[model samples]
Target: MIQASISAVPGLIVSFLILAALVAAPTALVAKARSKPWPLRTALAVYLVGIAAVTLLPGDAGLESWQCDTGMPTRLFTSVSSLLNIALFAPGALLAVFLFRRPVTVAAAFGALSGALELAQSAGHLGRSCSVTDLAANATGALLGSSAGALWIYLRRQSPGKPLRDLAWGMSLGALAVLAVGGVFESRIDRVDIVARDDQKRALAETAVQADEWITAAARGVFGSDTQVRQTATATASVTEPDEGGCRLRITATTNHGTISGSWPAKTLESARSSDVRADEGSLGAREVAAAAARLAREWFPQHAAGSVQRVRPVGHGPTTVYRVTYRRYAHGVLMPMRLDLTLTGTGRVLGFAAETVADPVLPPVTVDEAEAKALAQGAAGAPGEFRRALLLARQVRGVWRPVWLVGDGSGGRASGRDVAVDAVTGERIAGEISGAATPTAATGGPPSSR
Candidate 1:
């Protein structure tokens, strides 16, 4: 996590510099005319501008909605990003204390500023998540900064201005204000739930060894053989029922470069970079990108090499394009639950990769035909719209992976559109919400004609 945070500093510093230059001269002139400490005041002004620039600016317009972090205060220091949040407010609070000669008030004001910034990030659609842990970290930094300023005044034999009583009052009021702001933001943004289930079927040491092997292979395959990758945190494994009478191990391991999270022993692996790598100049066509992605997928998941390319679409484009290439496996002419999705840059650098490990799934025979499944789905949705395509795919329902008919209206393509999944065996409605799997494109190939 620290490595990831360090990698982001260069970009943040560049944004800060651009905004600081615009405000510095005017701020310095205003402070100089007032016979105040211009340098410190101007520095404070520039710092505040930097805060706004990093926290309030819009980012990744493709994000769907605002998210909130409700992690405990005890977990804050474990993340280097949280530590950076504390440092973001320290200097400003220290400056405020010196200029105002009121440590308590300075601390409270800085705390309020932190709360306001968090609220703005969520409300202003800035693509930054609101975090309670950040609020706590920032307030801690303000208190530490103000205390240092007070100690300096005491050392110089100057009036250590604010009384202890003022500290109590200021903190009480600040707490109330921050709580109110947090409440408002919490109601407005989506909360992220972290579940820690105690259902480990494998030993911690065994999980660690498996994680090491996977991460080592992933780093070598995704990044390069020369790149050294080390796990930043301990690996964890939990037992999950993917089918009746069968349980799979879900393993997650974080590394200096990226994260490796998925299941094992009937495995799935999702390797994602902590930050975007610099893409090469120029763009590649969809077919070219798909070809490159197929090679990478084959290397990592050899079992899925026989799978057909379901879709190839450009998700992001600029100096280089980022393509989403999807592949689905089939067993005896019926789509298996196995899938591989690779997000690659135009130069074929793997930004993200998700693939299911191959295992001969014990699936029930598909009794329901495509026509019957589509009728059931349309009846459930109460819409007589024509389904662009109907495909037989395996879906998990009630802890069991079973064959299902995925029928879509193709109104919003694959990513944003709604689809219905009907159980191929029972002819029951499985999923009547947004489509979960990528819809096959005509350019690549359609689903099996038998469907």
Candidate 2:
């Protein structure tokens, strides 16, 4: 709070000067017809300016534009200041209605002002979201103030002395009711900085295939011999080139089961052990594949872990079809973030598998469900980083799978988003993947995964 007040000074000065310039003429005119206009209008102006400064100022950086900013996703309405943001504007609207004796005009004008402020925050890259919900809350406060002021005016006419005090008491009672209703509001997990589109992988696949620059054999062997394999490679060589930390490539195979994607560098292939067709006594299905994968990916297994099938799909066409089995970690009904995927050819040959790892010993409780975790993820998207979405997953650490929330932003490729992992239960940020424009801290650093 102290830091907030101190930082708000610069914003307050600027907001006051700008607002005064825009409203000086109207304010001057109102002063002519009103009693105590100067003091009241001045107070209203101060209130308006103060609210603006408090809400929008003290950004992470100075005078940022869209091009240069990069911010993390921020959760909204989770702090005392957020509530204060709504309350601070109420007095100004009340003062305006008192001055102009026009509740509707004051309410409508203040509502428009609130909208404009939200718009500016979004467009101006001022380190805040142009949230529709915030606008509604601001407008609601203005309306509440207008009602109070108008009621006070009415009561004054009906009973001259102590009318304002009576109105204040009534409003206090109403405010209590509003607070009671507001108690239900909770902070939601929102996924921000998402993949721009699903088609993003398509372009990379096309390019790697066109250039014939990526590994096709590993995917072919893993996804099945006859499944049609498509691959794409990208790195951070130049603005138009894929050439970052070497080059990462993705192999997508369309099989009869649906689609299976494998990613790695050609030389640094993350090799996997596959099963022989004759080894499995049971028929092919989600359950059969999951059981088989559990054995193959036993290195990732924990004494406390159990496996459930997330999906089973047949992709590709013709002579060979690969059934992709996605086996996920589970704790009771809650899905853990850790996963192991298995693909099988028509002949029941194991195609390949990939699994996630967790180095952190901390496993969060399941306090936050998927819905709330998702909301938190979206709110994590920050400046220049529009929130895309979040997913709940478990990362394997010391052979134990822990629940995690994966947050992402818009970048590109498999590793392109500003990604962060959070402890699902504790709401504490866990260092895992840092993919967007920012560099990873030492604790969160790891080899960038392909998918």
Candidate 3:
């Protein structure tokens, strides 16, 4: 239980703190307003907003234990989770309802707020999920809170003018109880460092996959896809050790996405650097190329997408040197995806960038309304097991899809094969044996199929 509390503590703490303020502020106003509809309505409104903020602000994806990625045969309990959500929120909502006479207004406010939270998640604007299950759960919580309030009102009406102090005590005690219960599920503090290089970014990602100890060190707990950093201090690597010149970089990321204090190290920085001061004029250098790409990319994304640009120097480049820039963009929903990659060059010049778009394969096109991209993606999964595992290991990448001309499949298999180019945003294929192979063309820089 302590372990569970520690893991989920972050979300829980934020949720409860916000909930407390919402509960106290509104209840006080509602109490002062007496039977008036406005005060209670306003409180409900604030509560809903609070819920949305708490749900979204945390970068960590709930608790590590909360997520079970067993691979293939995955079960997304939209229904069960939804039910649990209702159980979670219903009590508070019912309490609010019982405390007010305007049940209809409360219901409307609760539903609208729940819907808005879900929409934020759906749009992928918020880090949290926009789940139908959450909507249902929020609604249920609101209803239950309101109902409890209604019951209290009914009992109070029996005594007519009995001391108002009596009611105040009960409400106060109830609030305290809620707060106490919340204490059991708070998430601990976590710190994470966001690096400026793609290879570094992936190095951290790989650590999460390859070394459990590494992740435990970085996060202070079992890390998950959603481990969040409350505050980040940026430090430019003062010196890049030439010996650690592998494409992947090693960084320390600390998080508490687990039951106990788990300090873990995860590698993050990754990129290609110039082997030496080269004189290849026409061939743009990695840093210079990345900068130019970032500028172009910023111009390319949907204006509304939330993003940031980071400047990175290849280890040895000194104070006067201009390094590469990495561009990161995040959006909402199951389709709400985030893409991160390079943009600028070593000379601080513009360069091409890489991007990834994570969207539900079934969502129809906003432009041509073509076939569902998700279905097409799934069809490429090769098999059902592959389909199930794909979700767990989906890695979107950029780069022109290049065809490995006449590539041999080995094992006395000399059939021509097209190599799938995976850059930074979209690439997921289940392993399977195929009889023949097709030649792959250089990525034209569009969809996976185009590659």
CA deviation > 4 Å runs, candidate 1: 1-203, 206-210, 241-257, 262-268, 282-288, 307-311, 315-319, 358-360, 399-401, 415-418, 426-445, 448-451
Expressed as tens digits, the lDDT of each residue in 104-212 for candidate 1 is 8788888888888766755666556566677788888888888888887788888855577667777787888878886786577676532111113434446657666
What value does the lDDT take at residue 16 in candidate 3?
57
TM-score of each: 0.44, 0.31, 0.26
RMSD of 1: 18.0
TM-score-best of 1 and 2: 1
- The number of the candidate with the highest lDDT is 1
The TM-score measured for candidate 3 stands at 0.26
Model 1: lDDT of residue 197: 18
Using TM-score, rank the candidates from best to worst. 1, 2, 3
- Candidate 2 Cα deviation (angstroms), residue 6: 6.0
Task: State which candidate has the highest TM-score.
Answer: 1
Rank the candidate models, highest lDDT first. Answer: 1, 2, 3
Cα lDDT tens digits, model 2, 182-202, are 332222213233222223465
What TM-score would you give candidate 2 relative to the actual structure? 0.31
Write down the TM-score for model 1: 0.44
